[model samples]
Target chain A: MLAIVVLLVIWWVAYWLKLQPPHLLPSPLDVWGTFTKLLTNGAVWEAVTKSLQRAFLGFAISVVLGTLLGLALAQFTLFRRAFGPLITGLQILPSIAWVPAAILWFSISTEAMLFVVILGATPSIANGLASGIAQMPSIYPRVGKMLGATGFDAIRFVILPAALPGYIAGLRQGWAFAWRSLMAAELIAYAPALGIGLGQVLQQGRELVDMPMVMTAIILILFVGILVELCIFAPLERYVLKQRGLAGAKR
Target chain B: MSESTIVPDSSPRAVAERSGLHVPESLIDAATAVSINRVSKSFGNDLNPDGSLRAPVLKEISLDVRQGEFVCLLGASGCGKSTLLNLIAGLDSPTQGTIETPGGRTALMFQESALFPWLTAGDNIKLALRLADVPKAEWNDEIERLLELVHLGGQGSKRIHELSGGMRQRVALARALAQRSKILLMDEPFAALDAITRDVLHEELSRIWQEQDLTIIFVTHNVREAVRLGQRVMLMSSRPGTFVRQWDVDVTGERRIEAPEIAALASEITTDLRREIRRHAK
Candidate 1:
């Protein structure tokens, strides 16, 4: 609620100052009008659904792949020695870098969007989990062994729980990457089959020179990011941190 | 709290008897729960420039911990009391000599509670039970029982941060006991607590130790704490840690920190420890 009010105040100030042309910066009222029209037409909801589906799918794939890879890297010396440098290098590369290859490989489909999202997100998740596993206190594994917690039980009960805070942090980073990658993919490859996403709407507004529509699309994208963080990732992160007593009761 | 209630069906006697049956001749021959035979530990593979082997942290340390005995390894900061405890717990290996512990497991409690922060107090105990392969049917009841043992019967659901410093250590004790191990290794577990809480814990520890009959090897730099807790106090010299002196404490019933014997023994150990530290300075 406070964010909305602040955004409105910024919009009013920008309009009063005549900052840029009307085609470049639309008034808050103009963006609201476009929002209402888009809402009534159901286009905003459709775009939101499509974007959410892609983001969630990409996130799921990243989590599974990242966790397994993280565990492998943490547990095996050979794997760590072989892939450690490559993994670090991969983290530095932006998701935008994969756009060309993703377009060629998956050809402007949902698969292409997912490919970029995974490429962007997996390294963060894997690194988070790997570092967390490494940081576990030395006493934990020894206690597990003394109690006969070998094989799967040791990994499941002891190792995983010990590393969970780090893993959750990684997942949060991965989600951000996935969200960004989805927007990038949608902008680059706008097609009917790919459906309408925020990026596609922004692109359409750009072509028609509809500044209010473009501002609406950009606002919607920002809104969606903040909403997801509050509704999904923030709560999840809070719960994990609270469980470990890392986050105080301020939330 | 009920005065006559037993914590769990898995009594300490039963655990002792079970381990007694499995005791190897090597361990039983020494009539001790742990027998360290000329054990020496050193870090790295390098020899000194003078063509002599590097000094060991523990040098040919031979010691025996009799069954159900409370032994304190008293020394200065670098005297390697903790190193010896680690070797005894099988977390590290001795460079030379042999340690014979009756095939039974040893539970160690660190200076920090070291409880799994993700788990609640009850769940932490449950994890120990789960790792020990206690039957699923018995876990819930056993957790409650263990909580009662530590005077935390209703605090099973409390998170680590919710508990006070002293309370967390008690829960840690309950978790360690949940393993049902024959030997318990404690490395300055109470050093971090306030003096009043430390006094309370000292009483709690003695009561629990007496009731449980656990073979404990406690490591501490505090001479008074050693005199107060251990049946026998073994003093180690610094630089290359070697046994400097040993004192058998004779305190009947519940011992007090203010008791003359306790003070006298502490002073004796302190004098010996001081001399050892002074020798290293030279």
Candidate 2:
């Protein structure tokens, strides 16, 4: 709430000071009006649902592949030695790098967008999970062994649960990357077959020189990101922390 | 809590004696719970710049613990007493010779309690029971009985974080009991607790030991703690830890940590422990 107010104040001050012309950077009130206009017209909902569907699909696939990759990296010395550095390198590489190659491979369709999203998100999730497992308290696995949880059972009930906070961290970072990658993909691949997304709308706004629409699109993107974080990842992170009594809530 | 009410049914162990981490075609005679035969454990592969081998943590240690024995293996810090207990628990293997717990998979307790923070005290015990292959239907009642055994009755619903250090250890004790193992290994389980809590746990442990008929090999650096709990105390030398001395406390009734007998025995053990430390100082 404080962040929203501060951001609004910053935008209002900037508008009052004429940081940029009205066509370039419009007033917060102007952007708000554009936002309401878009909302009432219902075009924003189509873009939102389209982008969200693609994001979720890409993220879900990334989660599976990333987790498997992460576990293999954490578990096998050969896998870690072979691919660990490569995964770290991929994490540093931006989503933009993948767009041209993805577009060439899949021709500006859902496949291209998904390919970019997966490439962008998977490395961070895998790395986060791998690192978390690596730093897991040594005592937990030993305790599990003593209690007769061997092999897969140990991984499922003991090791994975112990490494949960790390896995959750991976999921959180992975989602952010997925969202950013999706937007980048949408912005670049403005093909008719790609339909419309928030990023495509923002690109259209820029082409038409509509600053209010651009601001509105930007805020919508930010709003979706914040909403997902609060609605999904926040509860998950909170649940894990609460399990360990680290959530700081009064017992 | 009355001691008489905490009597455990022997039927559980009798019925499940065959269920363990690994089934054996033959077990060592029932008289001995554990037999460590010339066991030596050394960290492998790692070497000094001089290309010399590191001294084994446990150097040719041999011992036999009878059924229902509460044996304390006492030593100073870095004496590898925990390494020995770890060997007995079958978490690690001896580099040379053999350590066998024929009775089955041994339950272990550590100074930190080792309770999963994600689980409530009861659920922790349930996890142990489930892993031990105890029937699912019996979990709730067994959890109640085990918590009651540790004098933490009705506290099973509490989260591990909700419990104090001493209470957490009690919950750990209850969880250990849930494993239904014939042997229990403790490595400085109470070393992290306050003196008063430690003393109280000692008494509780003694009562539970007799009631459960468990063979416990408790390792600790504290001389007074060793004398306070164990029926037979074995003192290990420093560094490459090997048992050097043993004494049996002949007292039958309640033993106080500060009693004259306890103090006398503690001082004598401290002397042996100090002599081992002095060798390092030299």
TM-score, cand. 1: 0.86
- Cα lDDT tens digits for candidate 2, A1-251: 89989988998898889888877988888888899999998889999989899999999999999989999999999999999999999999998899999999999899999999999899989998898889888898898888889998898878788888898999999999999999999999997566899889999999999989888888889889879988999888988888798777533
Q: Tens digit of lDDT per residue, candidate 1, span A45-113?
A: 999898989888998999999998899989999999999889878888889889889989889888888
Error of 1 at A157 (Å): 3.4
The residue ranges of model 1 lying beyond 4 angstroms of the native Cα positions read: A1-27, A72-85, A133-155, B1-31, B48-53
* Residue A131 alpha-carbon offset, candidate 1, angstroms: 3.9
Give the DockQ (2 decimals) of all models: 0.58, 0.71
List ranges where model 2 is wrong by over 4 Å.
A1-27, A207-209, B1-30, B45-54, B258-260
lDDT of each: 0.83, 0.84
**Collision pairs in model 1:** none
What is each candidate's fraction of native interface contacts (fnat)? 0.69, 0.75
